[model samples]
Target: MSNDVEHAKRALRAELRERRQLLSDAQRETAAAAIGARLDALVDSIGARSISCFLSTTTEPGTRDFVARAAGRGIRVLLPITRADGLLDWAVATDDGEIAEGLHGLPEPTGEVLSPMAVNDVDLMIIPAAAVDRTGMRMGWGRGYFDKTIGSMQKCPPVYAVIYDSEVLDSLPREVHDQPVTGVVTPTQTLNLSQTRH
Candidate 1:
């Protein structure tokens, strides 16, 4: 990463960390409900049978409730594993379970990792981000893990970014390796970019 991009990432990360800390219990509960509703709407819109979604950690948006809801409805769920080289490898979550602390202090599946599935096999993928724009541009944690992983997929699934409505901003600085989401879901709205060019 260039020095400028690296600096931008660091600034964004700090801003997000501070933002997370400022949330009151009531605000967090309301935000979680809104996020959950948006997720449900997006899932219904896609009508996918199987999905590959991240198991969100506390530092990120809460996805456990959403994942459990999906699993209850018979949708397959997949969580990512960070490989030795900092790339992501996905595996299906065996059953309803809690997030186990893993690399970078992110939450992952506690169950045994299942056989790998082709990316195209997943109908949808929910991505975590620090910030996103209306045009589907995402600002991630600067690791490029999702970018590399998504690049390898023959058929890219409908990518949905989960963020607070506040995180959707006017624009975010971009780099060549930055991957864009196909859709964005906030507590208030779900913006579909597949039909609209960014």
Candidate 2:
């Protein structure tokens, strides 16, 4: 990653963070409901019995509704628990799963921890992103956890990043380690941006 590209990503992330912060509580709820519906449809279309998803922070597009609904439908939902070594451990998402502030103050499941390789069986992955470009290149929130996970998977599934509709851009700064997703799920629609789904 060149210094210029790194600088650009940092600036863009800061701006996007501010934009998310500006959204009112009502706006967040409406967007969360819309996004959850779209995600449910996506899962049905893919016929994914098991999937990996991230618990959204307050500023991010809410995914708790989708997670809870998915678990209720008997679709095994795995939530990522961030590891100290910059990797993610998996935990099954339960309707009554307790959430605790983990490393970096992110929400994590307080259940029996599974290994990082626990994500291998997931049929799909729904991850977080600062933004994603039209080409599917995801600009994560300066953390390489998702990038590393996607890159390391031997039989990676269709990975989708959830963001606001406005966060889907024409282009974004990409580094060599930055991984592209198969699609993006926004409040209004789900866009499949890559042909590489497996």
Model 2 collision count: 0
TM-score of 2: 0.98
Best by TM-score: 2
Model 1 pairs in collision? none
TM-score of each: 0.89, 0.98
lDDT (10s digit) by residue, model 2, range 74-174: 99999998888999998999988689998989998888889999999999999999999999999998979999999999999999999999999999998
lDDT of 1 at 106: 77
> What TM-score would candidate 1 get against the native?
0.89
Residue 5 error for model 2, in Å? 0.7
> Alpha-carbon error at 128 in model 1, in Å?
0.2
Tens-digit per-residue lDDT, 1-198, candidate 1: 578877877898789878977877687777777887788777788898888788766556677787888888888877887666867666666545766677777777776565344455888889888988767788887777887777667778789888887888877778887778897877778887544322
